[model samples]
Target chain A: MSEVAVSIEHVSKKFRLYHERNQSIKSAVMRGRRSVHEDFWALKDVGFEVPVGSTFGLIGSNGSGKSTLLKCLAKIYYPETGSITYNGKIAALLEVGSGFHPELSGRENIFLNGSILGMSKKEITAKFDEIVDFSGVEKFIDQPVKNYSSGMYVRLGFSVAINVNPDILVVDEVLAVGDTEFQAKCAQKFRDFKNQGRTVILVSHSMTSVREMCDSAAWLSHGELVKVGPADETIDAYLDSLPGASAA
Target chain B: MRYLKEVLASRELLANLTLREIRGQYKRTIFGQLWSLVNPLASMLVYTLVFAFILRVEPEAGDPSGLDIFAVWLLCGLLPFAFFSNVVQQGMGSILGNVGLVQKVYFARIVLPLSKVGSVGYNWLFEMGVLVVVLVIFGAFVWPWLPLVVVTMVLLAIFAAGIALMLAVANVHFRDTQYFVSIIMQIWMYLTPIIYPISLVAVQSDKYGGLFGTSVTILDVYRINPLERFVAVFRQLLYDNRWPDPQDFLLCAIWALAAFTVGLWIFRRSEKGLAEAL
Candidate 1:
């Protein structure tokens, strides 16, 4: 029997969009609640399992619900009906350091971002040096993160998030934040995680990354799971099925 | 209750976010956090000048003697009212303002609103310190019921949190709610007895002339206006130095419950969509 890290059983998420921007007295009086919404499902009936120590890649076009499914697995959004049970701690780099304050120093951001990621103060203190070292921002640790380049900011965020030693890591196309060299380093880290038998759920549009890193691949199309299997075969099938694959 | 407990369990994140807010607002400013007290102090100065000197508004004829009675009266009403209004308006933007943060974590969503309570509490505490200094300077220290003022401020905070939670939820799905909040606050301020005693509007209507552009006391409008009782409670206890009528607390309890329930319901309903929208 496979040791499962995460189990997703028939999950779905729906969103309501409003045509009117504001619900003020004037709008309510004049427009009378302007034609609000028909439901839009970001995900529907998605079911999957990531066994312990396996690297699973999710590939889909934008707005195809790959990221939404990852979010549901991360518990960022609860499923409408079905349940997701996670066996161990999951650290998601959904958006690298989205909470970074403009005026706070990089050192301060490490603590803040670490805590925001659910790390205790004691954990931060213990791993502080390693995080700064990994970020390669020791020279600018005291400088406010706002002054850092986007690449530098992502390095700091990724370093902190990866160092959390989470059992399950959820990465959402954020690995492209830094330069190619940094991207290579992140990929190497993923390899190490894979070698050490940690579970990873990666959402990316890059077919190359999916083939290089993932043991298995899943293709999501319009909130539905379209394909799942071994990385090479599944990715080959997905690419073959694309609109202009034969012509290209 | 289970949700509240879950939020409480994430108290560290709430405190961290609140600290971020307090520091972020004043981080690079010259005076830093001292500005919290400076703002309310400045408003007190202007109101004291306008009413005591320009309009020559006086308390009822048989009011007791005190240090610079105008300042006492103005502060007595303004302090609690400002605290509540500031918390509410500031909190309207709190959840939406920090939508970015909420998108990243699995922490309790209530942390967003509760953090507003913390930051506003910080501001109110600073304002309270200034109030104490003012009392000392004006020799208004002998009031026997001062402890109850603490209770009043706490109630105002609960009331503020309740309203803030409602606004935070509403503002997320509806952008215009924030703008409407500003207009509502302006009108609500006038309806509240912060600038002038509600008793003045209640008892001496004929003497004051279409008082405040109406032939009625704010007390007469209490049923429609929620702030009436909250302001009346503070005015009674702080300005008159007596226990607030218990009826005021009852009304506050109702407002608190209503705002909490509606706000929580809206937030829970809307929260699932926050990630995509943000």
Candidate 2:
């Protein structure tokens, strides 16, 4: 792609699987070592480029390192081997309301969560009403979020992450949150995001949605790249490779 | 230096997080923020009863101010030490307490501990304000020395933040750090001469010559504790209404800067691995 939003070249991530979850100094001293751990490679030389303004989907089976790769893109985890370079601001929706303090009111958490997501006070202020309106929790904004139903909590979180308005949006499986009406609203928001020429990268298990929503896709299996191509063809290949899939 | 710059750029987030802490601390309580004052007052009463009344421990009257009240004298040292302890304890847990946030979001991680300091420091100011008012009512001329008290308080806060930052990172790898630090803090409180007077140690040191027949006097080793110097400076400024000893002031400044620099260095080095370790 001529105008790339994100370029991931030869990225590899390693995780340490500790034999014993020994989180104590005494045990460490007694054992004469920190802990016994085996290095687990979560992502191995995975490389892909996301084009500007395009919706890119990552499809993989469970434990396929898609989440780890998404976290690396979000800057939450640093890759052990390679670098991920991106232009402009990037925001990640790894989990809805991850930073919300349950005791704070919804209005306060909006500001708290927004700032944690890298929006300035002025930016949050400008988008405050839009966020509350989108979440449809304006009536209970003053009440502490501990009283919020799980759906309302997730909706508010998703709204703030969406309104952050970054050059690149990194989303995990959080797309499946909230009711059908709210999900429809989110679909329209994503459409608007695409129309505004912003990059969107998501990880999802629903092959149908991946085929419908993504312009291009990448398939990962066991910490390696399986294929990167048009969304329909890649999803087809991914499905066909499954143990019991009938050839179309 | 790049990390410091990033933290400064995100000062707004720091402010918001601090506000969240201050607001959330007293939520759902019947007394609300009033408990802040009540907590110190209750401790003051208990310490006064045990040390001043029953044990017959007597602290000399304030030199220039002639403020002989034991309760007032006790508070000047007690308040600062309490603030220091709160900052260290709370800041040490900031990262571990917010595991969900750390794992999911990307921000300057130092903000977590620094915000703890800010929130507790805010409460410290209010507590000190009440103490100053009480001192004035008790005929102590604390007006001229008020600025110096503020300076000393800032230094103590920096020192506590540094220690807290170090412990926060340690606690992530070893869960026992918190419990261990709590025991150490209790012993440290008594060691700092908060409830008793430094004069007691000085008198004993003079009578015995030195500790265990060594060249080093007991008083020499007692002064080595940074909190001792902090409490001495606070007592000199607010209780005695005078400038602190130049040596004590210099030592406090050194401790504050050294602790903060070292704490920031440790926190930055471990910031990346924090998400995974948790």
Candidate 3:
């Protein structure tokens, strides 16, 4: 009954891995019968909810459905069962250059990326200078993003996402891509976002960052929710459960 | 009606995205935006040389007295066909190309395909302008049936948009859509009679003595083609210097409307899986 920014109930997502992922007529009709596929469950009856203006953290190893759950919340994947409901504007920095065009200049990519992210031209135009300055790539803004180094690419991408000011911001290990100073800047932005009463979903493998930033955390293991509670306690539990902890 | 209105309301995004696409293509190239014009002109030159000289061919009707002769006729067909072809090819890749955007953002997915359709149509208009100048050079200075040409171009845009919407969404799920589409379009060109007149079908049907003794004129078959109705309207207004045949325009509109509605339905239904597939 409490106000919620995102609500999830028993959502599950399954993917079928075809032998060849054949899409041709010859393949669809002929190879379809002969094709072998294994159904992989990326999520299994996963359930969680984030209250309005609360930060939520998802912690898990690779393939544990942290990103998959985020995608569902973003409406990128429809669950195979159950429902996910979300309210308010959303911005996902799941990966660097999620919608960037390699051939387009960094300046041009801002507009393309902004519009795709649901920002009006006016909104993007107003924040144009701020974005370029924050990215620290002012000189190369007019040069195509294709020419950017990986760090520069991440910086430009992060700059745009940070400027959008969406109600719910989802970050998936993107902070790990930059240098130390930029990482500190991103952490500060997260703090600013929380102070501004926005909902934040941070997925990271860095236990220290999670303990420092997240008030609450949820641990997912093998596509199941193992624990959800205070950040320090959940991380302690997650770390204790690791196979090599005792041996080490 | 509601969907169309929504698309219209979102025209700004569509225009911006279209510009993005054209600019994106030419971003690093020296002749960035000019390539839009250059591409079609290159094709026109090849066609003109190959047909006018090597094959020694001409429009079946020779030339309309006031209509800029064969150039207008050829231009009328070539420009629209180029627009339609570009939309299909560009649109097929649109969803795939913007997989990142579609996956991360909550905006209307239709914008991707519609923008491709609009930009290619915009390019078509520029090509049409050049065609007009070419006609003037040949001493063909007749004002076309303006209203008819506008209506025809609109129908052509809607039709191409419809096809693109369906293809773009499908291409995301089924990667093989490109191969099928290319082959389909190759055969479709011959079937649509872009380079030839529908009159040839009439002569052939008469020579073959009709299908099972029931006479079927190539003209009637051509009339049934949705593309033909739009092309006919274009040809009549632009080259024949006649006002649009209202009946033909109405029929073309109906077909376009139907295609657009169905195309949206297909696109929406398949959209949920695109991110996963990509």
Candidate 4:
């Protein structure tokens, strides 16, 4: 059997940019003059692979489609062309405000967000208190999340996200919101996942963290893959090609 | 087939999302979920005072409807219309509102619109409770037939859900589907025998000598509108304490099935583009 955890083959995605969204009644009526939409490709035939049990890093500039690629792997954004295959159950923490109804209490959000990631209610019930404890918001867990601080909110979100026991995990740059202690905890969790021989895909702009945590890395620029292979070497090439970092 | 399996696999998520939607609507308010009943009652009072009293428009009489109170008769049509309208209006906006979840998670896309349907159904339950109280107060309550509302609501919700799913996908791209929906629903309300009875259309059709130069009566043509049959069922069962034609149930079934299957087809066809489009 193939040991690949995720394989992407020439995948692409496009978006429509509306010149005028025409959200109002008046604008819709006035829009009869011309078409107000344009198609923009966000990913242009990008592809890569992550072997089982390895942490893979996806690095790129802001518009280089790093997050877009992660979304495809997470099955949030369907590829316009080509295909992506995954070998096991997948979970993703795409970004903050991952649709935790703000009015819901932190405890309720744990169940809500967990189920959204495909966890069953019985599974969530089994680990409910453990999740709240890991988030370190035990006292405030019963209160509506709208009342929590941004850090508390993200901490609770990250806590619920990381609790899922999927065979393959996808993480965006949501860890940037966490404090140093929680970041270290996440780093420890990453090492534990690697120890258990599960796949982890991480998307980050920070080359240092990518080199530190990932066994292999893929670099993308403008929705196209520019490099893939050993983490340290890929980061080195990506940095050397940058406008200023190479000269420095 | 794929969407069904997806929904079945993520049934727990659907339930959770539906609960979230139901709770979120009442969370911050002092009245909390009671607002569901309060909302429809408030609208019922305003229309009752205005349409039932001020205008003194004569309701179609000589039918089996026991209640001569204009408000009560109006409600039989109005409440069902209200339920249908609420589902469509809210269901259409489901996808746009949940772009946060839609763009983050991997699960059945149908659950998004269906969750809105579920929440509105929850509110409808409470509204029905208030309706029973109102009917008892007016002495028009039929104890045995009350459970029949459940049957009509299920069919109406399915039809509404089908339309909502289509609108949900469309609104994600056009951004104006909901706005257009508001205007269209108003025109629809006038056509569906909500304020005026179906007999009004029948009388006019007879007067006009059958529209389009055919002998077919206007009520027959209007009955082709799915909502007209649904409201008629509500009127017969709840307003008149009489049984709806069993054959009319077949029409309700056909419309419900057609809406559901077509809606799911459009949803699946558009599902792949949803994330990119958003």
Candidate 5:
């Protein structure tokens, strides 16, 4: 059996729900609400493992903590309890355009986003042409990203993100973007990642993709993991539990 | 302490972000980076028109630096103060501005404010270059201590960064801290003797030396403002054409260190929930 690439144990993340825009001092004084927020556990006692070279998918309904669990793996959000351990470098695509400056050119953004993702300038330089070629936006690379169409924007973000060569990649549902051609490219890229002995943990609502691509999957419902096992079994279990599935 | 090391380790991110900020500052403008030169130069012209030509404070008999051109003296103080104010204001608002990255990514949070301050250095360096050229054209080159001017800028940055970190963290929650910070900086510029002269404080304090029946001169209390010492260091470095008194350096260093320490304390304390706070 391959070594576990990521081991998440009893992970829980809590977020405060603010009543309104009260972060400003004037609002605090005017509203007279010193603590104007309540606590929420986005993820509750969730546990799972992603093994080396395996493609794992986190399948859950809306507000079911799929993204939160993925973020915990990416270390973007700290868990309130337990721990997540990663064996290798992680590159996460939590959202498109989160780090991109609309005023900067696509070329400059590659450098900026690459550096933020922990790649050095020289590494980005070496992969620069590949990234540009992969994104297929060479015609407007010099123009600021603000001028790019929404499709080009997300595609470029995806291209740069995957090109960074992460050992453990945690991809949010943002990959469900781009045209059919780009989606095919992403599918091919997933196969290439599996061939190279890298691990991938994808969070997606698309059951077909998860069933086809994931070696195993975890189903989450209402901030708790419902099942964890082989992809088909888990997806089947998840679908069976859905209220609409019984009628069908 | 661990935060310091994390920030240090993330120096590459800091450099890139600073470059991003510098480039973004002039992205849509036709002038581009030239705006860096234009901003301070324009301010200098306006201030010179008002403080130098309009006010026209004549040289006293025992004037410390014989060069009575208020423009040069005013630029010396104004440039540094402008740099300080920019650092503080931008630093405080930086986290909120980059809330996109703050919420989605995980890195050292201090880099947000620190890079804002670092980005201003790009503009300040160009502005200082222009200042040196203007001084040379005016035939008042303080050649030897010119290198020491670099030290003064660095010290000012350190002092500014410390305060920026504190304000940035506070602004993450209060949001009004940034607004109040600008107002404070405005009032601060007036009180710090940038438009007039330090000698004015000396003269006024002597005329009404005892405020509230205390023997202490108001000048003594006015000198307590560390920025006065920072600007004084720059003055001695370039305008006065002499190495500053070691005491000036000491006070500035102490302020820089103290502000940095306290700022880091607040920053580290608030770092955990930065995304939540914002």
Candidate 6:
């Protein structure tokens, strides 16, 4: 019961910063090389772990590697070194409904997006009605998603992702979506998730949400782990370290 | 081996993505699924007109089947070639086309290109079915050779998927790959014995002796193209209504296996960098 849900050990991800946006054979041939580029380490020897049944937050300023680290965890980006080990099914809610084909109806996309998030067709079919109800787009479910308002599209996407029922859920800044009522519904769902002893790994810049929801948090600065401890304390330390922030 | 396991594990995603491609291909069009059939029919008409009527490129009648329809013979080669080019062209752009999905989601990246093969293969099946109907109507006993036609189709799909996988990853790094492949495909089509008979090349090779006074004839060099072997196999099975030459069959299998192996090797080596490259 005390085992960690996910562990990140000495993880480092390197990115190439291309000087020129020349992605063509002609350009490479003319330059006598594959364009000018420099190696930049996005996540440098950063390490952290999320305990089973705990809500975990990764907090960092812009370009501090929090998102990059989360991406590495989600298997979107493979790290150059180290390893990320996780137990059970991991579903990432990064850019919800990203795989939805615009020409496909909302009803069809549910299955498509569900499968993309690693859900089986049987599981999607079982949860179909609930997904539709949660999105509140029942009337337009049979219509092509291109016709849906942007809000409806995202809501449907979020609904399918949240219903994936993964043991470990990785979310990135998607909590601020939908109207206020939908937000309340999502908050309630997160509470239910915690009650069920599942794990949630979140990447967010909103310190208030981190302090309120996360049991423990890791603060990253410039691709390095600055601190890892209780959520409130870590958030306070991160906030105080800001350039012009006053001591509360 | 581990990569294959990963791809196998994601078969559901591949199936769903393929369905998406099939359904979304002509969603807004008035004809809808009929467009799949109409496209090949339209091309067959144009080629039959130019090559058979104007150019006078008359291939000999099917031997045992005794079917002399130029359009049918043209289709036997044209359909498979169309499928191959479609898979390569679409699969090359598959990763780039799904930038949102590739960047945000994580599944076997191979599924992107493989799904293109599946979708295009679906259309190819329909085209093949229509061709079979035409053959039966023309009094050709294609039923006996149907299994070989399927076997050849599978080999061609594997070969095309291999090329597609390599091109998909390469296209991610170099945006020009798609454009470059388009030109190559057009030239490649002419080089293959699709419109003209392979016998024409054989006769020309005999007349010209050898290439640069060497022993390698033009036909020998031409058959080096894997697609030539595939077209010949399809013609032997579907058009000629007979067992294909064992050498051609073995060579098709070899080219398919080699292309798939090399393509997958290249794809795996560069796959980790695709998200960043895009």
Q: How well does each candidate reproduce the native contacts, as fnat?
A: 0.46, 0.82, 0.72, 0.84, 0.54, 0.82
Q: What is candidate 5's lDDT per residue for B133-225, written digit by digit as tens?
A: 876676665677787888778889999999999998888888779778889999999899787778877988999968799887899899999
lDDT of 6 by residue, B1-278 (tens): 88888888899999999999999998879987778888789989999999999999999999998999999999999999999999999999999999998889888889999999999999999989999999999999999899889999999999999999999988988888999999999999999999989999899989988888789988898899999999999999998999999999999999999999999999999887888888
Residue lDDT tens for model 2, B38-86: 9889999999999999998899999999989889999999999999999
lDDT of 6 by residue, A7-102 (tens): 899999999888975788888888887778788998999887789999999998999998998889889999999999998889888898888899
Best by lDDT: 2
Give per-residue CA lDDT, model 3, range A1-248, as digits (tens).
45788778998889888767666557778865635789988999988787777777899888899988888877778889989777887877776666687888899888877766667789999999988888899999989898999899989988888888999898887878689888888888888898998999889898878888887889998889999877888888888888886642
Higher lDDT: candidate 1 or 4? 4
DockQ of 2: 0.82
Sorted by TM-score (best first), the order is: 2, 6, 5, 4, 3, 1
Residue A40's lDDT within candidate 2 is 96
DockQ of 1: 0.47
Clashing pairs in model 5?
none
Please give the interface root mean square deviation for model 2, in Å. Answer: 1.0
Residues A1-248 of candidate 5: C-alpha lDDT, one tens digit per residue: 57999999998899888778676787888888766678898888988888999999999889998888877776667789989999998888888656898999999999888888778888899999999888899999999999999999988888888888989998888768789998899899989999999999999988899989999999988899899989999999888888898752
**Each candidate: chain B TM-score:** 0.85, 0.98, 0.87, 0.93, 0.94, 0.98
Could you give the interface RMSD of candidate 4 in angstroms? 2.5
Q: Is candidate 2 or candidate 6 better by lDDT?
A: 2
Candidate 6 iRMSD, 1 decimal: 1.0
Number of the candidate with higher lDDT, 1 or 5: 5
Residue B169 lDDT in candidate 6: 88
TM-score of each: 0.88, 0.98, 0.91, 0.93, 0.94, 0.97
Q: What tens digits encode model 4's per-residue C-alpha lDDT throughout B86-126? A: 88998888888877777787778888888988998888877
State which candidate, 2 or 5, has the greater TM-score.
2
Docking class of 2: high
> Please, what are the lDDT tens digits per residue for candidate 1 over residues B104-162?
66766777777788888888778776776666566554366567777766767777887
* TM-score, cand. 4: 0.93
Clashing pairs in 6: none
Which whole-number lDDT from 0 to 100 does residue A73 have in model 4? 86
RMSD each, Å: 3.8, 1.3, 2.7, 2.6, 2.2, 1.5
Instruction: By DockQ, rank the candidates, best first.
Output: 2, 6, 4, 5, 3, 1
